[model samples]
Target: MDLKNKILQTPTGKKLLSEYQLNLLTKNNIETLLDFHDAENQKLNKLLAIKLESVLEIKKELDMLPWQSETFVETVNELDFGTGIEELDKFLDSIAQPFRRGRVWEVCGQTGVGKTQLMYTLALNFVWKHKLQVLFIDTKQDFSTKRIQDMLLERKVDQETSEKAMADIHVVEVLTSEELIEVLKAFDQQMTDDVQAALKTKVVVVDSLAACFVDHRGREMRRTRDSLLTEVACRVRKLAVRGVAFVIGNISFSQDSGTF
Candidate 1:
């Protein structure tokens, strides 16, 4: 493949660079990976420089792989996963940008409105259909293997498939916002590791993000809460870039005025 085609083949390159930026590279005579690597230290505009840095980071990761390793581009799926609901999937597909990997989805609703249930369904659907893994971060200590098993049985899934699906849905309990951040950071590292098990994790479902910050009530802890949330967002985005889809569950607090 030529330089342009090679760059476009990688997820990071296709995501980070725009048509104009690619043209700019052509104008600058940076035609190959070797050429770009040599120009790494050259002065560039701020926006392009920042985008190039991320692409370069992905290149570095690919370089670290063994010569016999599979192509880096094949490590992640380029297609979108459905919500396991026919109507909902159709509706999302009608949108200009339908839900897909490398994106964060928020499922927010009032308590007892089936937010967590929806998260469970998504995780189950992803694992069962794709034979991929899901990282279910349970913040409220409500993750139940039995619940998932029951769901599988309800669907008339065979015993062997049910067992395999359950095994693929890895659950981790996190109590506080700090703990959530640490877990996300750990998952981020796992994504870059050369482990096949880590690569199988395509979706991360965080059940009830609000539960982690339930104690951050009053003015004193507002800043702390916001900081933690920002950190969590950053970590989530990092993982999403590596082709992991994130489904974050949140509770909507109702007040006298309306639900917020």
Candidate 2:
């Protein structure tokens, strides 16, 4: 089976891949699966192993992976948010300079603000202008399909490129902080040296980090949230240094943080 679509086609398979397959494919180590004489022709199986061996050899040399991997979908590096889209380009520019290698961004703002919209804009910019990939980690479950469709429609994102970008934008949802941690770790394992060197992580948006603190107990929630951001910032930056730019969103606790 083609590894790219295999996990998605099977419920159990995706879970297994998320749970265990990550470590097996990391940079320093790789695990191989061999089939026992089932194709009715021993030579065919031998040929299969040889083909796989060749794949492994090339993959090892590159020290990265194709965009089909769990990590590759939206790991876009050179964010050319065009001077179009009204004056929003100015805003995006002032916020950060396409997140340098080893850098990640956290977009924090008030409720009903354009924070999420900004993410969508950046997504479009990365895909259309630079043709880089992306990985969108949605914590709020608010990554709306309708909104994405609307954005594409509004910006005239073409059918083919839109389809391709939609397919490449890897999305993972998590309800708890711990699960988010696991997801990022698994996502990080897919990065290769070549991909990282290109500043290719388009952006990783958490979409409201403050909401994660609301249901918890005490003021300590801030600490927990802070710690989580620290870890997330750390991992994404490592990939950023290799050419991945990251963007995470949060809600502000003070007027000093500003609404815009």
Candidate 3:
């Protein structure tokens, strides 16, 4: 038999009409199905209502997704990360220039070159001065609350104020490439339009983006790594477009693999 007749003859199709209460008729076919939904025929209308109700319920679930109705802001809040040291602050200012939305900033340096320190200072500035929340992706597991508190104290801020500033910052530790990817995906899910705007969140700092690549090597390593990084960079750019700034930190050990 033909497909339509086969379905009509099947036990499942019978159950759809009897058990599921779907309105199926011999006259109802593909072209007429559209008319069923569009027209006011009682039986066809009932079937359309049943299907549309399920569709509306599915839409309700989709509305709860994290990245819903996010507005893409053209400009972002600019804050200065000025440590007392003139030289360091100048460097910070240079890198963070045009500190607006939709920008993925990569900070590269060698060991002990103050990459983490700079990121911590930026996070502190965002939380304390700009009144913004920061999602700090601590891939290196070296994010120190004590360090933040100490910096706040040095600025003559009281203990309660310092604690409150630290509270605005959320940290996640991801050691492996898989863990990093999973954490980023989870973070994307949890971050909603309302949450981002209400908390004034704009910064996503990934400390040492290269640390996740420790075990990522093989003949296909280059291709896989490139694909992975491209995916991450695309996500970061999208987040940036929605008024979030992504600061990705990386390290280098060789002359050939120096900072670009």
lDDT of 3 by residue, 1-260 (tens): 23233334444343343423333433355232212222323343365344533323322332222332223234444443333356765775787655555456789988899899888887888677667688899987878888987888899987788878888898888887767766655555456535553336667889988888766655556545554554465456445545677878998668676332
Ranked candidates, highest lDDT first: 1, 3, 2
Write model 1 residue lDDT over 1-260, tens digit each, in one string.
Answer: 55566666667767876778777777888765545543532233342554434644545443333322123333444678887878878898888455577768999987899988888988998887889999999999978888888998899978898889999999999999889988887876666675777788889999889888888866777555555665576567557767889999987765763321
Q: On TM-score, who's better, 1 or 2?
A: 1
Model 3, residue 75: what's the lDDT? 43
The per-prediction CA RMSD against the true structure, in angstroms, equals: 9.9, 15.4, 14.9
TM-scores vs. true structure, each candidate: 0.69, 0.56, 0.61
Model 2 lDDT per residue over 88-132, tens place? 656767875533433457787767788888877776666666566
Best by lDDT: 1
Off by over 4 Å in 3: 1-96, 196-199, 218-220, 256-260
- Ordering by TM-score: 1, 3, 2
State, as a TM-score between 0 and 1, how close model 1 is to the true structure.
0.69
Steric clash pairs (candidate 3): 102-240
Misplaced by over 4 Å in model 2 are 1-102, 192-201, 215-217, 220-227, 254-260
User: Global CA lDDT of candidate 1, please?
Assistant: 0.73
Name the best candidate (by TM-score): 1
Q: Which pairs of residues collide in candidate 1? A: none
